[model samples]
Target chain A: MTHTDNGFSATRRLILQGASAVVLVGLGNLPFGLAPAFAAANDKYPEEAFKAKSEADAIKALYGKTPEASDKVKMDAPEIAENGAVVPVSVTTTLPDVTSISFLVAENPVALVASYKIPAGTMPSVANRIKMAKTSNVIVVVEAGGKLYSATKEVKVTVGGCGG
Target chain B: MASTIRVRATSSGETTEVQALIQHPMDSGFVKDAKGEIIPPHFIQQLTFEYDGKPVFTADWGGGVSKDPYVKFAFKGGKKGDELKVSWTDNKGASDTTTAKIQ
Candidate 1:
């Protein structure tokens, strides 16, 4: 076993060198590693739709008026979210002649999360999970028969979801 | 890969409706871990509903959405005992299909 110990040591050194080279190459390609801590700050949505902190603010931003809750729109969400990263939500409506459906998170950086255009003769319902930065209200706005109806449910986000 | 997708359809005299929620991780590229690495975008990109092998509804999505995406849509001609199949594909090329009988 000791006959070629010199060769074995040389091979071992070469293998270690190659492994370090691979690691260096991998780290060099990671743009996130090179940038300063402040350089990779989180980007905010450009649209003004998300800044609303209250239900009234969100509604005023979306419809130009504070929304009055009606029985027509129904919003469903967990009372206490175990994980704020993804909170499941569903909105259904019994309103007649629904035309559109939209969802908003009152406290998110941008309140307006998603909006769907329901085609004619189609059901006006949407189910989606949204990111909640904190405990906030999830609102659903429905347009039925050319009239807008809304609903809200308070969702408690115990942990941060937006890369906190 | 051949598991049956469960879909429930209900009709309230005037309109036929169906609702479905699939288990998926709709990762938007914007999400980052404690290490500050940008998590590549992974989201449901395609979804389709079929009734007896006939296409009924289709949807396309982007990374602006959240995780575990849920979608609800309705059709006019669904009836009790009809078969509804739903399938989805994520940005990473992973796919899942499920089906349920309309009741």
Candidate 2:
């Protein structure tokens, strides 16, 4: 009886400790919780975008509208990426009120790789290291004033980033 | 735990360039472990860069990004000795922040 009681108390203590940790994390009580409510209203990550198999479908799911190629969107990527695992991709736009920016890899299993929200007054430029399964046309989309614009650049990958 | 986010900022001309590397597995659920079991997806979901408490850059990342992801960006109005703070939150609800002085 005593052994069973001790085990039960230990389990209860663990449960309490777990609950407190979660509460502290959620409340941003830790030093790393600077912006506790960073995206409370818009933290809804698009589940459909990352699961999309085709570029068009991913763009459709993300913006609910088709994107048109625009000269205002500038995408800078290597003509050939020596390493597919860390292809440097950057996008800049002259468009105003830029709301969102996304990168799509044509040949990856899933087209949408990364998407970012550009808050007001911040620059509409972003750079990230993205993985490509193979040589593919990288598409960048920028949303501004409720309209979608895009630019594409073909990057040749010598090595496959996704497992062979 | 010590902050795993490493940040460096340098000023050139009128813009301040910031580069950061975050230590993370960035496991994609599609990958299998050595035991052939699927590794659950865990990645940094959001990363924010602040200059003196004002947000200058923010990113929404997914698992497709490589492990120990690196990001580079620049803002127009940064000066020397200014504090550049970076904070990130992973899908598991864990967060970390680190600060660097602009050079």
Compared with the true structure, all predictions reach lDDT values of 0.67, 0.85
Off by over 4 Å in 1: A1-71, A109-111, A117-128, B1-17, B45-66, B71-77, B85-103
TM-score of chain A for the candidates in order shown: 0.63, 0.75
Candidate 1 per-residue lDDT over residues A5-73, each given as its tens digit: 988999999999999999998788678665443222211121244345455665565456555689878
> Candidate 2: where is the Cα deviation over 4 Å?
A1-39, B12-14, B33-37
Best-performing candidate as measured by lDDT: 2
Error of 2 at A129 (Å): 0.7
Q: TM-score of predicted model 2?
A: 0.76
Native contacts kept, each candidate: 0.36, 0.50
